[model samples]
Target: MFSRFLVFLLFSCRSLAFEDTYVIGAGDTIQISVYGEKELSIDSLNINSSGKFEYPYLGELSALNKTPEQLKAEITQGLLGDYIISPKVRVSVVEFRNVYVNGEVKKPGGYEYQPGLTVDKAIALAGGFTDRASRSKVYIAQNGSDDNKNKVKLSEKVLPGDIIVIEQSFF
Candidate 1:
């Protein structure tokens, strides 16, 4: 039983890491640094709408659906020998994708996405909805999805670049 519990714990941690870590998306800003390569380092870079971005020597690489660790490995592999004899690359999301909150919220605007942020937490960040807000019919429109927006429960995980709206109750 103890051994089984330990295995479960290990797997759970790994699962949480992937679920919580920010996936690179359009509009997210990344900071990249290559050890020993000053010219290749950048403080901030935007992932364009196409999920691709330009890098020195690398030209353009798609960053969508990838994590920072994955991007770092990609950059390091691409720069090896051609750009640097031994390249150690690091990539970090300086600014994650925004979650837009509109309608019935005190502050209806975009807020920075945080790891493990849920729909309820986002609504809290927007000042906990208005007096006439309907908690049950909270709408979420995912990025890249069209006409597929649907109502979600409070505990639903809000991904980056999602638009949330709190419908006003007809009380």
Candidate 2:
């Protein structure tokens, strides 16, 4: 039916925009659960500054740039022999990393990153822009890299670890 086709189209478009596979990064908090093993489940584990985490049976595991599903697979594989038989492992991000907002914002600092966050929302979290802030001079440095800095608008989507700078306006 036309209605069914329209519903499918809508869902497909939504999925395209959704970040289904989020990469793990430093400062992110993760939770790992094994279906039947209480001791092996990690309620909450923060990825260290080096983007690595120590697991009981897995020893040191690098989580940087790996998706939660990928990490789950690694853990499941590591525990298959000695730790658990057929472990139904689940890994999820408990908290995302923070994004920094600096310059002309009143309360400029790092704020927790969330999905669908934009420059406008980040500025709001930083107590909005100062009176002298330049609305047209917003810039973003991805992952704190100045080399990647570029001019952006208020509607620009903010990524984790990004640095947003609001220049001072004079005129």
Candidate 3:
């Protein structure tokens, strides 16, 4: 049992790193840094509803569905030559999109997403399950996808912008 628990713990930690490969989307805030160029750096830059943000020179660059490194590359390429001979661009996600919890949760609403967020933790943030909440009927609908709602367990990791629904228990 101890070994099983240890494996589970390691798996959970490893799964949490999925955010590193997370696709940038609307409602996510990102930070862009250019080495030794304070004026070119931006902090807490929120991606607008259109999934685009205005950079210093690369006006209105799109960020939707792009990884941080991809955006960094775009910035670096854009700033090279005319803007800067050697642009050291760095892009990092400062804030992930909110995870929404609704249905049978006590305080159903959207909550800020954390790196290691799981179904259980997300429910806790929404004030936990109510009396009518059905633990077995929990479902998740990933943000920005056409996939149908999928059943999820308490231990399942919740990604940023995921919508969690706790169905009512008839019992």
Candidate 2 has its poorest 10 consecutive residues by lDDT at 13-22
| Model 3 spans > 4 angstroms off | 1-19, 144-147
Task: Give the range of the ten consecutive residues with the poorest summed lDDT in model 3.
Answer: 12-21
Q: Estimate each model's TM-score.
A: 0.81, 0.85, 0.85
lDDT of 1: 0.86
lDDT of each: 0.86, 0.89, 0.89
Q: Give the per-residue lDDT digits (tens) of candidate 2, residues 22-123.
A: 788888898999997898899988887787767887788888888887898899899997877788998888888999999999999999998789999999
Clashes (N, CA, C under 3 Å) per candidate = 0, 0, 0
Determine the backbone clash count of candidate 2: 0
Q: Model 3, residue 144: displacement in angstroms?
A: 6.1
How well is each residue in 1-171 modelled by candidate 1, as lDDT tens digits?
999999999889975685446578888998999877789999988888798878899998888888888888889999888778898888888887899988899999999988678999999999998999998889999973648798899999988889998899998
Quality of model 3 by C-alpha lDDT: 0.89
Question: Candidates sorted by lDDT, descending order?
Answer: 2, 3, 1
Model 3: residue 102 alpha-carbon error in angstroms: 0.5
Per-residue CA lDDT of model 3 for 13-53, tens digit only, reads: 77546645878988999999999999999977898778877
